[model samples]
Target chain A: QQPVQSPQAVILREGEDAVINCSSSKALYSVHWYRQKHGEAPVFLMILLKGGEQKGHEKISASFNEKKQQSSLYLTASQLSYSGTYFCGTEYLGSGANNLFFGTGTRLTVIP
Target chain B: EAGVVQSPRYKIIEKKQPVAFWCNPISGHNTLYWYRQNLGQGPELLIRYENEEAVDDSQLPKDRFSAERLKGVDSTLKIQPAELGDSAVYLCASSLVVSSYEQYFGPGTRLTVT
Candidate 1:
């Protein structure tokens, strides 16, 4: 099933911060974050594995809560380059469970 | 290393027409995936392949959509008699492995059904 994302869209001024939340009903073994600009392919940002894990790349960070089966992506000091649709994909572990399910997505627009 | 590659960046066709999209995964990647994205939505997996074997295809529209990764390097997704609703972006992704590995995506082919 597709995970749910909160604040479907948000606008941020340069230097502002924003957070996108993704929640899934099923337990997640890992969560993957990606960003996609208009008319472009999605680019992998970071991946958070199970075990109360957290990961970050530069100004982008994410935290995964195993108990809640949810994850959140944090964009700090947003820049124009950060304007895009962010998607969170969750992965589960089991026999024949190698696929990643993505969330509805949060569109972020940064203004100067 | 080069990233995943997809062909025919854009395609415009009429309903009932057939269309095909090609994808070449990153070198050394062992897993490939096909996804479809509608306007303002996240991509939904249509199928995934590990090497030459189809590991998952539960979301594929088997009736009209078929995909093949002949050599486990490059893949092809075909839609015969495409419908209006098929007018969306077809994305291809690859990873070192499908089991808990990060995925790299291609630019994708935008399909327009008139």
Candidate 2:
């Protein structure tokens, strides 16, 4: 099943903070975060393993809660370059081979 | 140092025409995936490949959509008799494994069917 992302869209000012949430119905082995600018490909941001292990870029951060089957992405001191569509992909264990199911997405606009 | 790459950044075709998109995964990556993204929506997985084998293709429309990965380094997705509804962005991504590794996406091919 695909993960569910909250807040269809968000607007923030430069240096502001924002959060994007992703939840899944099934147990997830990993949760991935990606950002795509207009007319561009999605860029890898971070990935959180089932054991609550988090890894990502230096500027973007995310946390996974195994108990809740959810993950949240936090953007601090947002910059104008952060404006893009954010998506969270979920992978389930026992689903066989590595496959990713992505959430709808969260459109973020950072005004400078 | 190079990321995933895709060709034909944009395509325009009439209904019933065949359209194909090509993708080259990152070097040394064994896992590859194809996804379809509609406007204003998130991407949906179409198929996945582990090496030269297709591990998952349940989401692919077998009647009109087909994909292949011969050498495990590059892949191709084809839509025969393309329909207007098939117009969307076809994205390809690759990862070392399905576990905790990040999947790097390539600039998708945007198809417009008339």
Candidate 3:
């Protein structure tokens, strides 16, 4: 099943921060985040696996709560380049397949 | 190293026609994935290949859609007798290993059904 992302869209200033939440009804093994601009491919941001391990690349960080089947991405001091649709992909641990179920996505716009 | 490569950045065809999209994954990447992204939505798994095998294609519409990853390096997705609802962007991605968290995506091929 696909995950559910909160705050369908968000607008922020250059120096502000934004948090995107992704929740799923099914159990999760890992969560991956990506950003996609219009007419462009989705760019990998970070990944958070089970055991509450948090990973960060640049100002973007993500935390996974395996128990809650939820993950949140934190973008601090956002920049113009951060404007894009954020997607969270979930993987089930027990499945034999390696496919990732993605969420609807959250559109983020950073103003100057 | 080059990322995934897809041909025909854009294509427009009438309904009931046939079209194909090609993808070349990064070298040495054993796992490749094909995703279809509709407007305002995230990419949905269409098929996944490990080496030269298509391990997963449950979401792919078998009646009109089929895919193959020959020789474990390149793949082709074909849609026969396309329908109006088949318009979307086809994305190709790859990772070094199976189920890798990070995936390198290509520019994607936008297909429009007339």
Candidate 4:
């Protein structure tokens, strides 16, 4: 099943902050975050495996809540290069295999 | 190291025609995946392979879609009499192993059926 993401689209100015949320109905074991630019492949940002554990890459970070079956991505002081579609991939518990069900996506646009 | 490689970055074919896509996973990677993504949407898993065997293909349309991985390295996906609805981006991805969480994706093949 696909996860649900909040704020289908967002617009922000440079130096601003944004938060994207992803929620799943089923129990989850891990959550992966990726960003895709136009006409490009999805690039991995980070992955959260444990509940309440947070991981960061540069100014981008993400957290996974195993109990709530949700994950949140935080972008601090956004830059123009941050403009892209962000996708959250979820791996459910008891899946036995490493299969990811991705969310719809969150379109983020950063402006000067 | 090179990421997953897919052939024919773009393809345009008429309805009822057959089409095929090829993929070569990263060396030493034991897991490969095929996903189809429609515009403005995320990638949907079509099939997954562990080594040379297909471990999951439930989402694949068996009636017209078929896939094969030989020697646990290269893979090919074929569609017979493709329909207009099949127009989408086919992506190939690979991970170090079946239990690995990080997946590297290729540029993807864009298919347009008229």
Candidate 5:
């Protein structure tokens, strides 16, 4: 099953903050975040494999909640370069095992 | 070093025609994957290979779609008698191992079935 991403689209100013959430029904082992610009391949942002652990880069970070089977990506002080579609790839415990099932996507537009 | 590479950035073929897409993954990656992405949708896995053996192909449409990874480094995906629905971006990704969730993706081949 595919994970569901919230806020199908988001518009923010260059220094604003935004959050993208991904929820799954299955028990997850890991959550991966990626960003893709128009006509470009998705680029890896971060991967959270441990429960309650959050990883960050620059102003972007993500947290995985094992109990809720959900992941949230946080973009603080968003930059214009952050304009792209964000996707979350989830790895679950069983059934169709060992695959990263991705979410639909969240389009983010950062205005100057 | 170099990232995954795919040939023919774009392809256009008439329905019922045969087409093939090739991929060369990053050096040393042992796992290769083929995913099909429809417009406005996330990619769906078509097939996955560890080395030269396909371990997960349950999502692959066996009747018309086929894939092969020879020598465990390069791979190819082929569609015979393509249907209009087959028009989509074909993405190839590679990782260090099956459980190595972090993947490196190629630019992908945009196929158009007319």
Candidate 6:
């Protein structure tokens, strides 16, 4: 099943910080994060496996909570180029298939 | 070290027409995926392939949508008798293996049906 993302949209000024949350009804095996700018492909940011591990990518980081079936992405000191739609792809447990079910998305706009 | 590649970055077709999109995954990648993304929504899996075999296609609309990954490298997705609601971006992605976490995506094909 697809995950649910909170704060459907967010607006931030340069150097600000933002948090996007993703929750799934079913158990998860991994949570993958990606960002897509207008007219471009979604680029991989990072992935957190089921161990409740947290990973960072530059100023962006994400945390996965296996017990709660939730993941949160942290964008600290956001930049103008960070304006885009963020999506969380969830791989459900016991699905047996290596497929990702993506959430609706969170629109983030960083202004000067 | 090229990323995934897709053809026909944009396409416009009328209802009841046929359309096809092509994809070439990064070299040595063993898993390929096809996703359909609608406006204001996240990409949804349409099909997935491991090497030359289809591993998952339950979400694919079998009545009108079909896909193939031949020779374990290139793939093609076809939609026959397209409908207006079929307008969306088709994204192709690949990973080193089925269990690989990170998937590299290609520039998607934006389909507009009139």
Candidates' C-alpha lDDT:
0.91, 0.90, 0.91, 0.92, 0.91, 0.93
lDDT of 4 at B84: 98
Clashing pairs in 1: none
Is 1 or 4 the stronger prediction by DockQ?
A: 4
Worst 10 residues of 4 chain A by lDDT: A45-54
Query: What's model 4's TM-score?
Result: 0.97
Chain A TM-score values, per prediction = 0.94, 0.94, 0.95, 0.95, 0.95, 0.96
Error of 2 at B53 (Å): 0.6
Using lDDT as the measure, name the better of candidate 2 and candidate 6. 6
Candidate 4 overall lDDT versus native = 0.92
Show where candidate 3 strays beyond 4 Å.
none
Model 6: per-residue Cα lDDT over B1-114, one tens digit each: 789999999999999999999999999999999999999999999999999999888999999999998799999999998999999999999998787369999999999999
- The lowest-lDDT stretch of 10 consecutive residues in candidate 5 chain A is A91-100
lDDT of 4 at A62: 85
Q: What does chain B score (TM) in every candidate?
A: 0.98, 0.98, 0.97, 0.98, 0.97, 0.98
State iRMS for model 6: 1.1
Q: Pick the candidate with the highest lDDT.
A: 6
* Superposed Cα deviation of residue B18, candidate 5 (Å): 0.2
What is the interface RMSD, in angstroms, for predicted model 3? Answer: 1.3
Q: What is the per-residue lDDT of model 1 for residues A18-110, given as tens digits with 9 covering 90 to 100?
A: 999999888788888999999999999988888845898999999999989889999999999999999998887562555878887899999
Could you give candidate 5's per-residue lDDT for residues A13-57 as a string of tens digits? 999999999999989988889998999898989889855468998
lDDT of 5 at B16: 97
DockQ of each: 0.77, 0.76, 0.77, 0.79, 0.67, 0.79
Q: Compared with the true structure, what per-residue lDDT tens digits does model 5 show for residues B18-55?
A: 99999999999999999999998888889989899998
> How good is the docking of model 3, as DockQ?
0.77
Cα lDDT tens digits, model 3, B1-114, are 788899989999999999999999989989999999999989999889889998888889999999998789999999999999999999999998885458899999999999
Q: Model 4: runs farther than 4 Å from truth? A: none
Docking class of 1: medium
For candidate 2, give the lDDT of residue A12.
Answer: 98
